[model samples]
Target: MCSHYEPVITKKQLATHFKVADLEDGLKPELWPGYIGPFIRKHEYADVGDDAVPFRELMVGSFGMIPHWSKDTKIARMTYNARSETVAEKPSFRDAWRLNRHCIIPAQAIFEPDWSTGKAVPTRIVRTDGKPMGIAGIWTGWKNPANGEILRSFSMLTVNADDHEFMRNFHKPQDEKRMVVILQEEDYDGWLSATWQDSRQYLKQFPAELMQTQTEAWTTDLP
Candidate 1:
């Protein structure tokens, strides 16, 4: 799973990809740790907005999952990604997963470390079709008890990539292989409103055939 990723900063995520309306709080070009980014969840009747929106609603959230019990926002640094196998049991991620607070993190690409050269080399992994990837995730809103300021946050869900052909090529040679769960475009609605049980079906790997890679390293300073 990637800790640093390029979010869907353009309108395609809502206008064509996810098909939502507003992109509140805007979005960041890159998300690392607590950086703000847009995530889409199933719209609820109680949500404040025009009643004419589609099934999904886009929102702004910190890249890391912030738990209700957290005293501050620092916890986000470690909760940026959740392991699918134990998501339902980890204290910080259990609640969101159990409640099925599912969301899709639209990303232009995700950066993974390629260690084949005996050193970590940053590599960008994107869909071969050049469309934004709708990554399966869980979200929650943490209210700052000091001032009652509520901040939404999310964590990308990931799976074991030991058997994955493309994903297994990234990361360390001795470390466990892992990759984020990328949902097919047609499954966007299904994943957004999925129950905890049904959610498991989408926590799988995206086919390598549909992906391409960038071997050149990039820097946030210039991006």
Candidate 2:
């Protein structure tokens, strides 16, 4: 599962990449489960027909998902990643999946542990061609009962990567290998518009040849 990532771009750049309007805020270079980050989704616009250009909106959303039925935000920590194989059947993600609430989590690169070394080392993985990735995700909104304020959050979907040449290197040797579903540029709209039944087709692993990894020595040092 993807737990750490970096978005090395300005709000304007992010908005431009998604062909959305300018955003007023930017995300931290590094983001964790509770941190807020940018996500793109279609928005309904008045006087716009379905055949017209789709209205896309780039907004900041909490990284972890807080289910609507949850009494508190504690669940967000464990809900950061939803497995693609059973997302539609999992209690935490089924509702959103059934409702087709999809979003795109864009990032410049992601961090994973490289276990080839004697000790686990933090390594950054990015596209060999230096393009950003748009990871597939599902989102939901929960209302803060006290203030009646809505908190939106999302979770990245992951698929088994044990057979993947590059992805199988991460995580502990005893643990099951998994990787986030990184959608291709041509499939972005299809993923976002897919029905629950069609969503499964987009959960396949990304090409390993287009990916590259780097380990920063300082990142593995003890605090």
Inter-residue clash pairs, candidate 1: none
TM-scores, all models, native as reference: 0.93, 0.91
Error of 2 at 133 (Å): 0.5
> What lDDT score is found at residue 96 in candidate 2?
92
Global lDDT for candidate 2? 0.82
Query: On residues 105-178, what C-alpha lDDT tens digit does candidate 1 reach at each position?
Result: 99999999889899988888899998889999999999998899999999999999999989999988989999
Among residues 3 or more apart in sequence or in different chains, the pairs in candidate 2 whose N, CA or C atoms overlap within 3 Å are: none
Candidates' C-alpha lDDT = 0.89, 0.82
Best by TM-score: 1
| Deviation (Å) of 92 in candidate 2 | 1.2
lDDT of 2 by residue, 98-213 (tens): 99888888888998887877677778999888788889999998888889898888999999999999999999998899999999988888887788888889999999897889
Model 1 RMSD to the real structure?
2.4
Clashes of each: 0, 0
